[model samples]
Target: MKCHRCGREIPEGDNYMHLGETLCEDCYLDIRMAVKACDPWAVHSATRFREGSGHKGTEGLTDLQKEIYELVKGKGKVRKEEVIENLNLSEQEMQRQLATLRHCELIKGRKEGDKVYLILYR
Candidate 1:
């Protein structure tokens, strides 16, 4: 069977049905935890954790996470699409990574005129 969300071919009995739509595991998870770029609680918690941990500036991040941070840091500000293309990440993958980075207080989204840009936090 083919997944309704991503069009990937799923073996029988391995597909997830969500809201009457068939989805692969990855797509289902992505839909379940939709990205929230402007979550104040996430920011506050991340800040508190960072202060308590004493690890500064991407010291305790995964390799991929650090790469994302550096990309945003070097560019100063970048569009979401640019990150996706540059990192060769799927939309869902990018969202998941971005959410984690945001929760860690490493990156944030900013609106300038008609576009949203990703920039390093602080």
Candidate 2:
């Protein structure tokens, strides 16, 4: 079976069902686990972790997170939809990754006119 969300092939017994959709392990876990960027404790924890580990910029981010950062950095700014399309990620996945990056103070959003774009935090 193929995951309904990510379209990855699911091995014989590894598929999961959610709201009538079949999902792979990764997609299932991603949906089950979510982190909010606006949580003060999350921000504090990320800040403390980065400072204590001496990891600057994108050093401590996941490979995908780093890629997202680089994509934004390279472009100066990009719409959320553009990043989601470029990375081929679900909206939820993009939100989670962007949350982590935002918590780490690596990326942020900017409003230009009526549009919001993701850009490096400075």
Candidate 3:
């Protein structure tokens, strides 16, 4: 079978049905288990991991994370839709990356009237 989301071929037993769509394992997990940016424990753990590993600034981050940080830093502020469009990212994937960036305290969200913007934390 093929995954409805990414059009990837699914192995016999590795397909998942979500919201009436057949998805491969990765796509299924993307929709079902988005990481949250507001979990205090997550922030603490990410901080300790960075400190323990002596990582500074964007050090130790994934390439995608660094790219996201750079985009936000360069733009000053951006909407979620803009990031997704500019990076060609799925909403679920974008949320996961954003959550990680937030846990590292590299980015934050601000509400401006009816819309929210992503910006550097400091």
Best by TM-score: 1
TM-score of each: 0.59, 0.57, 0.58
lDDT for each residue of candidate 2 in 72-115, tens digit (9 for 90 to 100) = 98999999999999999999789879867776678999999999
**lDDT digits (tens) for residues 23-44 of candidate 3:** 9999777655434323556656
Worst 10-residue lDDT window for candidate 3 reads: 31-40
Q: Enumerate residue pairs that collide in model 3.
A: none
Write down the lDDT of every candidate, Cα atoms only: 0.79, 0.81, 0.81
State in Å the error of residue 36, model 1.
16
* Model 2 TM-score, 2 decimals: 0.57
Q: Tell me which of candidates 1 and 2 scores higher on TM-score.
A: 1
Query: Which residue pairs collide, candidate 1?
Result: none
* Clashing residue pairs found in predicted model 2: none
* Model 3, C-alpha of 120: deviation from truth (Å): 0.4
| Model 3 stretches with alpha carbons more than 4 Å out | 1-56
